[model samples]
Target: MSTAWAGGTDAILERMEQMTSLFVEETRKSMYKGESATHCEECGEEIPESRRLAIPCKYCVDCQTALEKGSK
Candidate 1:
C-alpha cells in the first residue's frame, strides 16, 4: 500500500541506520588502547591533559598535525 516515494524514503532511512552502525563499530575499533601517553612520542614534550583526554593517543598536537600533513 506504500507509495513509491514512501518506499524510497524508508530505504534511505534503513541505509542511513546501517551506515551509522558501521561508523560506530569502526570508531570503537580505531580508538586508542591502554593508558594515555603523557609525552609526545616524536618530540618528548609533555602532552597537555586536555589533549590526552581528547585523543588518548601517542602523539602531541604539533607532532600529530605534522604527521597528518605529511600523509596528505
Candidate 2:
C-alpha cells in the first residue's frame, strides 16, 4: 500500500515538474515585446488615427488582422 502511494506521488511530482517547465517557457516568450509584421505596433500603422492612440507599439492593422485570422 505504501509503495502504491509512493508511485502516485512520483507521478504527481513528475507532472508538476513538466507544468513548471512549460510555465517557464511561456514566461520567456512573453518577455519579448512583439512579433515582426512590417507595420508599427503602437499606432497600427503610420496612417491610421488609431495609431496615435496606441503609441509605442509595432504591428499594423492589416498584420494584426491576418495574425488573428491565422490563429483561428
Candidate 3:
C-alpha cells in the first residue's frame, strides 16, 4: 500500500513538472508576441532583418544566445 502511494505521488509530481514547463513556455511566448524592435534590447546592437523576421521579438543574435544560455 505504501509503495503504491509513493508511485502515485511520483507520477503526480512528474505531471506537475511537465505542466509547469508548458506554462512557462507559453507565458514567454505571449510576453514576446507582437513585440518587434530594430535593436537588441540588451546590448543596443542593430538587429538583422532576417533575425527580425525569424524571431519577431527583441534581442539580437548574440544577446539572444547569451540569454538562452543564462536561462539554461
Candidate 4:
C-alpha cells in the first residue's frame, strides 16, 4: 500500500529502534544495581571514582564509553 521503504529508510529505522531498545534495557539494568564501586564486569577495569560517585555502579568508564561509541 506504500512505497516509503523502497529507499531502505524503513530498514534503517527498524534497526535503530531495535538498537535503542537494547541500549535502554542494558542501561536500566546497570543503573538499578547496588551502590558499589563499579567495575567493568566485561573487562575487569576499575571505573573512575567520579563516575561511581555520580552513577553508583558504572564499572569501567573507558570500556563503557568505547561501547557507546561503537554503538553509534
User: Pick by lDDT: which candidate is best?
Assistant: 3
lDDT, model 2, position 62 = 62
**Could you give candidate 4's per-residue lDDT for residues 1-72 as a string of tens digits?**
568668788789999999999999998877757785657776888877887777766547666777768952
- Model 3: lDDT equals 0.86
Give the least accurate 10-residue stretch of model 1, judged by summed lDDT. Answer: 27-36
TM-score computed on alpha carbons, candidate 2: 0.40
TM for every model, in the order presented, reads: 0.53, 0.40, 0.70, 0.42
Write down the lDDT of every candidate, Cα atoms only: 0.83, 0.61, 0.86, 0.75
Worst 10 residues of 4 by lDDT: 55-64
How much is 23 displaced in model 1, in angstroms? 9.2
Worst 10 residues of 3 by lDDT: 1-10
For residues 1-72, write the lDDT of model 2, one tens digit per residue. Answer: 567676589789999999999998887667534644345554446535465355433456665567658852
Model 1, residue 63: displacement in angstroms? 0.1
Model 2: residues >4 Å from true position, as ranges? 1-4, 35-72
Model 3 lDDT per residue over 1-72, tens place? 566676589789999999999999999889789958999889899999898887777988888888889962
Deviation from truth (RMSD, Å), model 3: 3.1
Candidate achieving the largest TM-score:
3
Candidate 3: stretches off by over 4 Å: 1-4
Task: Write the residue-wise lDDT of candidate 1 on 1-72 in tens digits.
Answer: 757676599789999999999998888667666767999888999999998887677878888899879962
lDDT of 4: 0.75
